[model samples]
Target: MGRLLSKEDVLAYAIASTALSTGGGGVGPSLESVAKMYDDAIAKGARPELIELSEVPDDAIVTSVVATGGGVSPEMMMRWGGRGGRLRRDLPFGRFDPEYIRDKILENDATWCPLNSWSKIPGPDFRRKAWERLKELIGGKEIFSRLFFEISPFVTRDLCYMSLEGMKAIDATCAGYRAAPEISQSGLNLADVKCTPAVITTVWGDLLILEEVLCFQRAEEIVEGIATYSGGVAGGPFALTGKEAKKGMIPGCISFTIDIGKAILKARESGDDIAEAIVDASKGRAFKLFEGKIAEYWQEPKYSFIWGMVKIKGTGKYAGHRFKAWYKNEFHISWLDDKPYVTSPDGINVIDPKTGWGLANFWPAEWEPGREVVVIGVKNDERWETPRGLKLFGPQHFFFDIEHVPIDKIYKNFE
Candidate 1:
């Protein structure tokens, strides 16, 4: 039977999903706003629901919804390479192309540009227009379920928003626990499920539909390029059948995110360790990676991605040691005392020690120096352990030469 979620459930999911989002998934003040939207939405009669993949009929249609463009705020980007702080001009994804950025987005009278900080970013209702456009294309086909493109507060909010339109949330995601930098990182690619007939929409009212894609790689380039120029977007591909959803999604993640949130809330109420609560919620699949104070942080916007790194000075048992992590919207690589540690497809979360909130990399202020944090490693979905999955998500895929190591094995080795 499908389960109907209460307002509290979604509130919890919003908070907990941030921790699971690695370093991305719309954390910080944005997450606070998402939580409020949930309460407000539910108060106005929205009843979000979740169902297992098995509950969907073979003919049931599943629609994927997502927003692109997660780079640091224009305010932060404006501060780059100024005064004492410095940021890398590029990484293996390729060098930052200023001329290309200028020609594509700035010259088009974009609200936010290198010279101006007035960001015309997407709003909470960003998807409404896109959804309407998609509805027009799909005709009268009732959407059986809404699939999460990734884990984040936005995902839960999208769930509630769709429920208001009568679509249930699928207890699954295209990516695993953490967010990915590319659309091609989705399990849909691994399962050979196509995501064409995709709809890409921007806040400025521009809409484009992809009747077909040559491959996942081409789709990523096309969608990301458009999003890059449009200053972020909403809308995604649809036409996933129940059988295809079962094959292309990582299931049970919604409940798992809620469980983690519930654990944290219970711990806070009982005056227990929030970090320990997270570990317990994962049923031992998560482990405390470090307890530390932010020692240094650096970030810059590149190609609609917030690429950055953070250094943490250890405390307590980890005293005298240091840890560092690198991210492209989400943390993808880490090192303990400068030795290679956990990498992508696994999670590396920097969380508030007391509140258990994820300190998002997308928002640079969250990682300011002196903030105390607890870093944790949660296991990725089992599907990511395969060769194809590794090829798509591992450290090497991000141009890092390090091998992908499972969280448990990394912890065991550290011990």
Candidate 2:
């Protein structure tokens, strides 16, 4: 007979698989990123440890981590599988430059879990929907005693939901929530996988459903469905655990393909392979569903030596790539772009406060990382960069530094 498979075994296998691909870089003793996540989990008071997969009970609750397109996604990324072209209508690829392109590439391949695999997904909600439909085949009252649950690691980033009180609740519900899955995502390095018990409710289900529905190809449909029900935000849905609206995780029943597996019972005349069905149900369906969405905005990443970087935005140390937008702040000064505004050792200078034009051969943000006095803004020639706006000797006299100027001060002119 084949060995009995447990939820813990599946999780362990995934970690092992990723490690093989990373060539021993994941969850290793020296991996700081992985370690930090563990430490953070412990500090939060959840006993997250790593251990052999064999330790998990057959009935213990397990949550799967789904990750995909690690960061912001371009229009093309949304259209996966054979249907990509048909669905490709107008995908948004925001402002592009050297830095922007590099960010997009890294975002796609960054070490992730749950949704993204070493290469591909389960085929367009393929894994999830398949499981839900499978239920039709195996109706109630006959087999398994518990419910199947799944989740994505990315949603854990919701600071509001992952509160101290929240973890305690989760820990209390489940005998023990495993801590080794995304050890890198945690602050602890030493992982001693632990498992006890876990429980979930529709409250959890509602949250997962909303998050994914919005990110799916049929977002509009999901939103409409959510509108029919209560406990939603003005424009989005949230975890249903009596929390505020969070359109992060959407949960629901997905359809499955029947032909993939034989009857639930292959032994008895009036029965099927009840044992196999129990095992299969305990795990997920041949197919799985993933309901998630990418955010509309991402933060503009600042790079420096301390960040272990150089030559970015087509200049600096790592040049050649065009500077582009990975995530644009609601507002940013296009004048400076990705280039650092450096300053010299000399004291600050200013043109006219009313005229916001001044220039310095150097900017402060460009200097090496160290405690150094930085002159705010300085001016030299007719064309200079100044925090007090700029004064151009030329006729056009362009001024775009409105950002630095105070709202009230803008109407007044200073000598």
Candidate 3:
């Protein structure tokens, strides 16, 4: 049994996806446009089903932003093993490489520089060109999956609804943190899109001529509104603005010392009088004086000159770990008071589970990474009540991953 989709509904989805992707997609905003088309179709009274993956039309188009090592082939494996006359290619009895896995990908491109999506698109029509170029870059499908396996055993495993296809250059840093990870191919599948080995293909398996994931059957409505497209990766004005623009983009800079000094330092410290200090510091910065809600107390958390020199004079026993000494930034500084916890993969995120997205260009993590990411176009971002206590990837919670890159990779800096 399936729920029927209407043209109006599809149009709504398009509104949502495009809104979410306001910045860009590799294929000339095609995905967003497609989403809009679906919405339009729904408006026309046509129905799209939120069906199980098992029910996917065999002939439909299926592609994954996720990719496996391309060099690997059935012939090479047979030559190497010399036995196992018949085997299932889809079911790998061993490890797999996922973009999440870094070490293995290095074998293919010594300089397999990492990359992510920017609010704006960087390369050519990326969505379409992935498999062809990646296959050439590595070797081909089979061997490439093998290369990926060396990097990620995680991807090989059958996770809950979706599977991970490892991507990275040999010894890529996704194991913990890596520089710009390119999107060879990626995307999540409906958990049961196609269980049959013949129907569903893994990155490690051969690239089939045609395929599609099972339908999505989740919430009918998105709580978050469509995010407006800003621009490609670095499309934002002064993204990662060296020492100059860090303050305006993020919150809690050194200015907090005088403005919101107490709240910033009270974290993991003498929790006393810190709140009072925050109030005292706010003299002229804010248009209106706030008691505990002093806006000036917060900085963007990047390493700014004002913040570097700013130090918190300890009161009674709390002396060390002073605000001046905090090396990370204002974002990381938040973990001092509130740490994050990694939730299950089912958690909500900026990228839709069904559509899948990559790192935006110009985003902090794109260049040096280990940069704090702030999701600009979150749906329902300004709600008076946030969904849950899950603050790691929550719209309001912006910062680095536990791996210390950004929120996408980890739940919290403290977690």
Q: Give the top-scoring candidate (lDDT).
A: 1
Per-residue alpha-carbon lDDT of candidate 1 for residues 1-415, written as tens digits (9 for 90 to 100): 6798876677678778878888887643344565677777788778778888678898888776434565534543342211122232112221123333434445445444344365553444554666666777778677776778777866766666767777778888788777777887888889999777778775444567888778776887777666665554334656678888888888888888989988988887899999989998898779899989999999877566778899999988888999999998889999999999888888899999898888877567567799999999988888898999998898878899898888888873234
> Per-prediction TM-score, please?
0.84, 0.19, 0.23
How well is each residue in 70-181 modelled by candidate 2, as lDDT tens digits?
1112332332101111122122332222244334335545533223344332222223342243333334212111111111121122211233333211211010111111
Write down the TM-score for model 1: 0.84
Q: Tens-digit lDDT track for model 3 on 1-415? A: 3344333333322222221221122111233444454555445543333332333333333222222111122333322111121122122322232331233223322444333343222222232233454344333332211111111112211111111232111111111111101121111111112211111122222123222223211110010000001000110000011121111111211112112322323321554432233223434221110111111121221111112111222222332222221111111222212343222111111221112221222122221212211221111111112233113222233333432222233322210
Query: Candidate 2 has what TM-score?
Result: 0.19
Which of the two candidates, 1 or 2, achieves a greater TM-score against the reference?
1
**How far in Å is the alpha carbon of 39 misplaced in model 1?**
4.5
Over 4 Å off in model 1, which ranges?
28-39, 65-67, 72-129, 136-139, 412-415
Off by over 4 Å in 3: 2-4, 11-50, 57-62, 67-336, 342-415
Q: What does the lDDT read for residue 164 in candidate 2?
A: 36
Instruction: Order the candidates by TM-score, highest first.
Output: 1, 3, 2
